[model samples]
Target: ERGLLCALALSREQFVTPGHALVLRLVRLSAEATAPHVEPALLAQKPLLDRHGNAPVYVAQNLLEQLAARFEFSASDDEFQAYRKCLRPRSLDENAPRPLVGRAIELLQFKAVIEATQECQDGHVVYVRGMAGIGKTRLVSEFLEM
Candidate 1:
């Protein structure tokens, strides 16, 4: 978080800038540091960087080494197609409903879903059904935000 914040401030660009290599090195070091506590399954699931030319690994290592020598980290991809998959920004569908404010009444439906799940012995799906202009999506979005 600290390094990203530093990069964000330093770059001052509108879009995501390069410095991702630093994040990878930091996560790698953190995972190694916390290896004992983390499950093998979790580490196995993590994406690994092979020796490739997407982004230079040596540059990342040098930056990490330089930064590590200066200050401690107190706070905190693949090929072209793979990189796109990894770095793609979450885009909302054109018809996706936007969240509506001042919708406290919608929370009752959320609570009902929660209560139903608690009482059920078997797993069940709580489908939010409603017609157009109704606030079903908005209600669910609010519930998730909460």
Candidate 2:
């Protein structure tokens, strides 16, 4: 909660530093400052990926390496995908749509008009249609309520 408050305190206009990488290389010559023998040996080892094309492994590795060096996280592809999914937002809740049948009936009105004109009956099977929010659905609801 405190962290959230602190984050909320930050202004959207604030400028933030992205990331900075620092590489360190140490050389030792036979338990001491090594000449340059290690450089050739290290270069001789073939890279994990061939030079044909950027493989998924290399791409994922590069992404993970960048994320690790920047965010201090070295996650696998599945983990990264899961984390990315977390960043995505689900659409608005559809379980309960707005303007419920009763509420829509209230809005559509005309139910009173229908009741006044036609006698109410069970299974009336009233069908209302309109362009956009013209209240056809609401009309049906109002009639149903009556």
Candidate 3:
């Protein structure tokens, strides 16, 4: 009952319409269990939901199967562990430095250009045009990071 109400609210907030790609992705994810009890709600809205699509019915059926699979005992412990890991989000190191090749000289040139631009009079614009694949973006990012 509570889960059904929550599901209704979630669907409304997230715009979870029938036939949307999001429904398929949500069904496949390990966090499928975390979704509210939406079966009853979906059934109630079957007429309107199914008017333009039958995908919601199929997605709901697949979700039920996945939920049932969670309760079943696994034959292989390794496989089960792998499946669990897929559900967990990967962590990233924020302290890690950005990956950039040799650009120290270019950065210095860019800094000099910026200083020169600041000293320029009114209506003067400094354009840093260069060939593609040059370290223009990298130099700009490095300058901003400082």
Candidate 4:
């Protein structure tokens, strides 16, 4: 009964609905009956339960705190400095758009293949294979512009 109450309360906190609130109330009543007798004053003093007797917000808060503490990371200054030393900085104009050159014929061929595929219902795969920095990306960029 306690577990069921807890599950319902957590669900209610995540996605509130009248149905969940109703079920939670029913479960809480059942849980109260099954629980060992305790004074009303003492029950009210319990930190986990709220005025309505549901602890969903408290439980969720504690769960998140525990998870954050468990996964918290703190790197030392020396470690951070060492990690930074291995990084490569990019040039200011590395991503600047440049006009494609000397690949007009390849670009036209790529466009023709793409147009041919559009006319058919079947799927087609196009592979642009070339050595590194051989203008494959540039050709594709130019083709897309057309």
After superposition, which runs of candidate 1 have C-alpha atoms over 4 Å from their true positions? 1-102, 119-121
Write one digit per residue (lDDT tens) for candidate 1, span 13-47.
42322322322223345544654423222332344
Ranking by TM-score: 4, 3, 1, 2
lDDT tens per residue, model 3, 20-132: 31222143447545756554444434444233422221123323344332222223224122121112112446555645557777677767776777788434444667899
Tens digits of per-residue lDDT for model 4, 32-56: 4786333322322334323343332
TM-scores, in order shown? 0.26, 0.20, 0.26, 0.33
Cα RMSD (angstroms) for every candidate in the order listed: 16.0, 22.1, 16.3, 20.9
Better of 1 and 4 by TM-score: 4
Looking at model 4, how many pairs of residues clash? 0
Clashes of each: 0, 4, 0, 0
Badly placed stretches (over 4 Å) of model 2 are 1-90, 100-109, 118-127, 132-135, 142-146
Single out the weakest 10-residue window by summed lDDT for candidate 3: 80-89
Poorest 10 consecutive residues by lDDT, candidate 4: 80-89
Say what the RMSD of model 1 is: 16.0
lDDT of 4: 0.42
